[model samples]
Target: MNKINIVLADDELLFLQGLKAILGNEEHINILFDAKDGDHLIQQLRDAKTLPEIVVTDLKMPGLNGVEVTKIIHKEFPNIKVIALTSYFSKPFILNMISIGAVAYLAKNSTPALMIKTIEEVSKKGFHYDEQVMKYVHESITNPKDKKTKSTFDANYFTKREIEVLELICKQHTTADIGEKLFISPRTVEGHRNNLLLKTEAKNVAGLVIYALKNKMVSIENDSL
Candidate 1:
């Protein structure tokens, strides 16, 4: 079977190590590289002979966070997919990441299974997002005077799986948790989250949540976030 090549970038050494350990168990995944920050990730990408299929990254790092890393990766390797793993779920962050070309966004709370499942979906479909995240993101954003930007994730392009992912993301479930609930791998959940970020043009989880809320994609009237 063809294995999926992956790279991880995060500032927290312990967290990075823990994630690596979890991902190491997957048969189909191959971690090609790791970086302490976005700048290092870019340097590694530049120096490497082979490129990874996907990159899992933290949103906030010492220098050049996930969003910056994503911008570089998207520009240097348009074909490569990106997944943002973060603690913050704000609108600007989500929108920023989306603009930078990341395909998905997963919270640090996600589980290994969710990560795997999201990865599978992203590898196959090229995008994913938690349903709740999507709902919040859509709702938070409004007209930015750039009609072109408005048309970026105009609701029609989302698939069923992507929508589901978006919902969960908004709910703030970790990739692993979402995976377990959805009966998929954590990687797959990560992939789905990335797909949602890409579709909705969200920078981080917060941005996604705002987008969902602004667009009325997910309602906040009856439910509490």
Candidate 2:
């Protein structure tokens, strides 16, 4: 199998270096580029001959934050997966990043092993969340009420079952696992997943997760609903 290409963007020099060093140790990943901010990230992409499989970015930066960078990345290279690395687990932060097209949300303090696991998982499964984020999520579940409305992103693309499948996918269950959990056959799970990718117009599981996250169809917070 080919190495998974990765681009990393973060404003803090020390943190950036640490992440680079940690991810560098992973034999399965290849660091394609590193950037200090969104502008530099874009410039790096322009300079690169080929796109990477994933872009791990810090949520807060000097110029363009991770959310804006994610939106830009999706607009330009819709195939690349965006993962948000942040210190805060605020609801707004998580929702906004998801809204912009992020496949994974992880706390900055997460272990190196967890980070590596998240990257690998999102690469295959499309989304991953650390325990911290999951805790925040479980704490925030209230009855679904419309507090505010932004321009609704296009969720008309996916069928209800497809959406259901995508959510289960994000929850990090395998096809067989999801089938057992949802009382569906593994073959049916696979079919719904394929249809989910088609309807979401995403090339891979990461893209599908990004679509689900950005459209608010799936929440990073422990969604009991």
Candidate 3:
């Protein structure tokens, strides 16, 4: 079995050590390193011989901060996924992180089991949001105060196959699952997904889902997991 390589960043020593110890026990998880602050985290990423597949970072840090680090990772190391682990579980915080390219968001108080599940799901599916986060996402789209400039879907924007793939993705279907349901190869599903990302100007799968929701391409009732 292939291990999931990850790096962790947190300012609190006890919390950071505890998190490391918990994740370190999982046979499928390999901790590449741990950093005490956002600056250190970026430096570690820059100096590493092998980059981690995922980075789990705390939002409140001394320098750069989790949001800043996430933005940097999204821009500089696009392949490396980010999971925001912070005490702030407000809807705005969660929505902000998702929009900025975090593939998962977790409260610092999240259970070890949930944390493990999130890591595995994100490793396989590219993003993982709990029901609560999903609710926030839906509400963010519907709430008039939180609304952004509306995007209109052009009839020529995406092929029918791409729309099907996007709908499946918003419904939380994996690439293999989508391929099986759509009668296409997993690689083809991936190609469609890549095109969707490019056309929507989305940073990741999470961004794509948000774009679909914002554009009314998919409804929460239909896409809810």
Find the candidate with the highest lDDT and give its number: 3
lDDT of 2 by residue, 56-157 (tens): 998777666676778789998998999988885565567556656788888899899888988899888888866665554554454242112111222233
Worst 10 residues of 2 by lDDT: 146-155
Q: TM-scores for all candidates?
A: 0.62, 0.60, 0.64
Looking at model 3, which ten-residue stretch has the lowest summed lDDT?
Answer: 147-156
Q: Order the numbered candidates by TM-score, best leading.
A: 3, 1, 2
| Cα displacement (Å) at residue 117, model 2 | 0.2
RMSD to the native, candidate 3?
17.3
Q: Model 2, which residues run further than 4 Å from truth?
A: 130-225
* Span of ten consecutive residues with least summed lDDT in model 1: 145-154
Question: For residues 1-225, what per-residue lDDT tens digits would candidate 3 score against the true structure?
Answer: 589999999999999999999999999999999999999999999999999999999987876778888889999999999999998787657877887789999999999999999999999999999999999889988887543311122233478998899999999999999999999999999999998887677999999999898767775584445
Cα lDDT for residue 206, candidate 1: 94
Tens-digit per-residue lDDT, 1-225, candidate 1 = 689999999999999999899989888889998999888999999999999999998877766666666767888888889998888665555655666687788878888888888887788889887786576457556555222232223223466776777777778777887798789998888888887787677899899899887765664455444
- Candidate 3 Cα misplacement greater than 4 A, ranges: 144-225
Clashes of 3: 0
- Supply candidate 3's per-residue lDDT for 13: 98
